[model samples]
Target: MTPELLLLSADRVGVLVFALSGGIAAVRNDMDLFGVIVLAFLPAVGGGTLRDLILDAPVFWLEDTVSLWLALLGGLLAFFFTRFLEDFKPLRWADAVGLALFAVTGAAKAWGMGHGFIIIAIMGVMTASAGGLIRDVVANRDPLLLKEDIYATAALAGAAVYAGLVYAGLDERIAFGLGMLAAFILRALAIVFKLSLPRARP
Candidate 1:
């Protein structure tokens, strides 16, 4: 496969994983199927959609319907395979992978749009966190942005790492790989070790 196609595939995989997470959250909250689907769609596409809108770029999923269908398929798979996954709990891993992939894609897209490094970092955070924000809102839970979790911080860290690599004249492929790896590794560590950023006292 072409390098561009491979990158696109990675991004799509992230979308699927995040979409499944949304659907799983819905099921755990006892939401109906429609609610589940909506949650899945939002978490999968929300960040990308927001980034595209902000950039005044064509919506990413509008040009290709594969993303939408993938989100649907992910939700369905999560719904039907819930019992099996419940035994081992795959959502954490899925979420880590998705966050890493989406953060890289988001920053790349922003850079492509001629945004500066800081703006690209913001886009990366938006792209990675939008889905979870939408899911939490739909499920009537406070989004991580409103809480103490290190969610967006993780995304920002990944984006900053990518920008640093690029600034250092690293190849795009290597930069993307390292940045994505950083996000996944950091997030997985956080989940596994219960590492969280400090919360400020009021």
Candidate 2:
């Protein structure tokens, strides 16, 4: 597939997964249908919205309404089937997958826009973590950004790897896949082992 098509696919996957994560969060918080939908929509597009705003680009969901529909669908499905997912914790893994995909796609978008490495990395991290941060805050929980785990760090590492590989003349698709894999593995290991960064000494 073309680079644009590949990125688009990644974006959709990230949106859907994050939307489900958000929906789960809303259900856990005892939110109503409207609240669930709102929460789902937030994480589904929040990061990309922030990135586009920062980049002075058109908002992605506005450009193509598929994202909005997907978010609503995910929310509604989760709302109606919360009982089915009670034993399955979907949030952590879904968030990790979304973060990995979004981070790589965000970096690719920044590179395509001719941004510098620093800006690309920043955008990638923002795209990966911003939505979850917003979701957590709205759910009255600690944002993952403030957590001790290697959340944003994983995104940054993946984005850096992708940017470096592309700069070094690797195929964009290959770079993106490798970057996503790296981020997913790191985040998954952190989750499996309950790992976190060292706390600052008071």
CA deviation > 4 Å runs, candidate 1: 1-9
Backbone clash total, candidate 1: 1
TM-score of 1: 0.90
Q: Candidate 1, residues 119-140: lDDT per residue as tens digits? A: 9899889999986887898799
For model 1, the run of ten residues with the poorest summed lDDT: 82-91
**Residue by residue across 11-124, what tens digits does model 2's lDDT show?**
677788788878888999999999999999888989989999999989887878999998998799779877775556765676687799889878888999999899999999
Judged by whole-model lDDT over C-alpha atoms, candidate 1 comes out at 0.83
Return the TM-score for candidate 2, rounded to 2 decimals: 0.89
Q: Which candidate is the best by TM-score?
A: 1
* Model 2: worst 10 consecutive residues (lDDT sum): 85-94
Residue pairs in clash, model 1: 43-131
- TM-score against truth, every candidate: 0.90, 0.89
lDDT agreement with native, every candidate: 0.83, 0.86
